[model samples]
Target: MTTTRTNKAWASNALAFATAATVTAIVTFTLHARVAADETPNSRPPMPVAQTQYKLQLSFEREQRFLGLIQAASRSQIGFEVPGAISEILVREGQAVAAGSPLASLDTQALVARRAAAAFDVDRASAELELASARTQRRAPLVKSGAISAQLFDDTRLAEKAVTSAFAAATAQLRALDIDLEKSVLRAPYAARIGRQLLDRGAVTQPGSAVFTLTSIADREAHIGVAVEQAQFLEVGQIYPLQWRSQSVRATLLAVRADVNPISMTTVAIFSVPADVEAFDGEPVSVSLPRTEPETGGWLPLSALIEGERGIWTVLALRERDNATLAVREAVEVLHVSGDQAYVRGSINDGDLVIADGVHRIAPGTLVAPISSSSVTLAEH
Candidate 1:
């Protein structure tokens, strides 16, 4: 048609001049990215954190532990102040005795035949007090030579004062058969070990029963019941370490029980042990104790706390200010954890810093960049 309508009006004026030079280079690149984002100056550059350096510590008091029991700070039982029949048991159940040793023997065969009938009534009362002092010294010169009558010299001076009161009742029955032959020999009062024997060899027993137990194992102890506020932090001579078997052993406290065991209502204490603690007489032993007050807390490290809520606890620390280093939070209370650390009480002080990574999301006034974990090396977690 007129040369194809002048080549379609020159391709619609070259497509409206390349759509107005692509809308004027997208409106001059969106106004030079809005004036370089308003002359850029939103500044940012802090946040590195990782910190750690609170130190000041000194709170101590939460120990507790438990397992305790081991006994034998004395243990007695050894009965036999007079019966009989166990004619010889000489110690065995764990033997090892010393102070007075002996241990058993009561077949005094009718007490050595009543001590040979009280030594034949003290040899017939020393032959009736030497025939009543030779007839009261030959009738005191025959009753002053009246020869013999004055009621026959007062009936031979009342038969020599009734033979000197039957020779003083036969020397008090030969001193009660020499104290029943020295209490039928039972012995062993201290330095001991034979913890049990009850009554072996012929048995019989009675006058107070219980034949052998003796224990003492060189003064051992370790009772532990606590809780009257842990027996008010046990005192009596204070020493305390305990553990036994797994070793440690230091003991000492020796007594706190002013009464209060009515079946573990708790409050016993008693320690002592340490004869190299081989621990026996009932055995168990663990004992820790401590806590009675004095614990304010602030150790930290359990990844620097967090758990909050009613049981409360938080941390983060770092503080500084205007020049930067923010992250402050803190709340804490924790009170004890140990192995990877954590005692906490916090409003956090003493060279503070903290933030040793409690999930480290970072925020509270952020700005961080702390770094000083003694110049860093950590890495174990």
Candidate 2:
């Protein structure tokens, strides 16, 4: 029993010594690793920051959009010139018609009867005119040769002249009737689309009354109202982009009216759209114009700016002072913002290194290693 107890004590002591040696070795390795890390180039380097260069600009172009309306180039109320009962309407509403296409016609039963009667009168007049001419020729010779008495010859000539006048009057009446008949039919004056049908068949219409509203399909125009100051920059015959029904279309500037709109307090600008574009009349559209603002500022990423006390803003810029690069806070006034970039003028100079992002985590005087972005990135919100 004594020998067994001694053996058990020896084994316990050996296990204890082995555990202590393992612990010591681990502690020594940790200390050596720490020392090696301290001897390296930078035990704790400055925080790396994304930066961008500031480019100073004398002015900036700001895009401004103006609303407008689309309209057909020509809209007209068309109707027949003669007063008559409507016999037929050839075209329906919204129908496309070519130039000279028949639109409607007036009832011609009475007109036809009158024209026939006038034709009979014209035929009778022609026969009478021929007989009168023969009689005048024959009577002239008779009076000269003294075969007939002077008084009788003169009476014959006078009767012939009266017949001639009567014949001319009858012929003119027939021609007038023919014109009235032709005027009873209405036709399209140009290539157009029927916008409205104002009258129906079997309705009697007077002269100059509207029968249809036709809108020209060949040409379309957009009439945009822009600010008076902005309109001055527009040039006639210049091409511009327009927004129509969520689509982009190009149009040519046609004219700028001299008068200003009283309600909108804007000037009117007219633009002509291409023929191939499918657009509706009286639709809404918009045009954008770039206007230069006279101000000196520099462009920077919006991420570089931070909000400060009441209407003030802050941006972190890298500066070298006391032989160390330090982050310097600048107070700036934002002149304009487009997409992800801002035009600002403040206590900053051209070519100043501005932190592009992550400004919240950094302090004003924190040492920073400015790693410039190779290229600036901009994205629409």
Candidate 3:
């Protein structure tokens, strides 16, 4: 019984030892396989990246566009001085007229009759005054020669003075009637274009009521609202370029108003447009003014920019590592963005090679084959 038990124990020990050896060999083989895999070369090829060289600038000028409107230099609502029923309208809307050109006329039948009566009264007064003057001259000689009583001669002279006063009053009334006759016709005060016809023929109108809207054709103006700070840079009488319907035109600076525009919150600048240029009143226009900003930065295509943590921006730059070009991230502060480019100042140096585009395909420290883009011009703004 003792021998059999000992044999059983020996078999059990042998089985345990074999199991331990198998486990140890399996672990060792797994570790060696991992080591061999690590030593193998990476199968993925290097990425091709377009690159541009960074060039630093001291400052940049941003073109600012200001919107404005074109207008006539002189605009007025024209009407007649005297009130009457309109008899004729000689001018039409959009008609060009010169100074003193007849625009409209009032019915002159009543004025003409009154003028004739006044003229007849004037003629009767003149004849009476001439008879009174002759009587006064004859009485003066008789009173001096003592042929007539002094009181009687004095009474005749006084009677002649009364007739003379009546004659003078009649003459003044005639002159006033003539003035009314001339005022019946409405004429243009200056060279202008008729903008609107407010009244038609035979329409009765009151005095000072607008009959037509006149806009001067000889002079034009541009009213532009610019920021108060920018307005200070403009000088009166200086010439500036303006854009009208995508075409460039020159205008002279006329004045700058002191009050700020309520809607735009900007100061107003008046400019005189050349008469030779054709433009309609109240047309929309714009002007570009160069605003220089003092900031040290460099320009890069917008594609090179990468959104970083906490609102900061990142740019990938190429560096020499292990005899191969590798992409490295550089933090930048974006000063200005215009068009497809941005002005940035940051950890990048002037002469550093920067990846221009396709940033999402690679990570930092990524090996890349840089394709030079030196032929392309850098952003100027």
Task: Identify the candidate with maximal TM-score.
Answer: 2
Local error of candidate 2 at residue 102 (angstroms): 1.9
Which lDDT values do the candidates have, in the order given?
A: 0.75, 0.89, 0.89
Please provide, for model 1 over 278-364, each residue's C-alpha lDDT reduced to its tens digit, 9 standing for 90 to 100.
Answer: 766887887776663466655657776777668677887887777767887878777667577766676787767787874358767
* Every candidate's CA RMSD: 13.6, 5.3, 8.9
Q: For candidate 3, lDDT tens digit of each residue in 1-381?
A: 999999999999999999999999999999999888775545357789999888898998888899999999899998888778999999999999998999999998988898899889889988888888898888888888999999998888887888888888888888887787788898998989999999988888888999999988887999999998899999999999999988999989999999997887899899998888778889988888889898998899999999977999999999998788899999999998889989999999998889998997889988898986864456666
Ranking by TM-score: 2, 3, 1
Indicate the residue-level lDDT of 61 in model 2.
83
Model 2, runs deviating above 4 Å: 1-43, 149-161, 308-311, 377-381
> Model 1 segments beyond 4 Å from truth?
1-71, 75-105, 108-116, 119-123, 130-134, 141-173, 176-178, 185-194, 202-211, 216-220, 223-298, 305-350, 356-359, 363-381
Clashes of each: 1, 0, 0
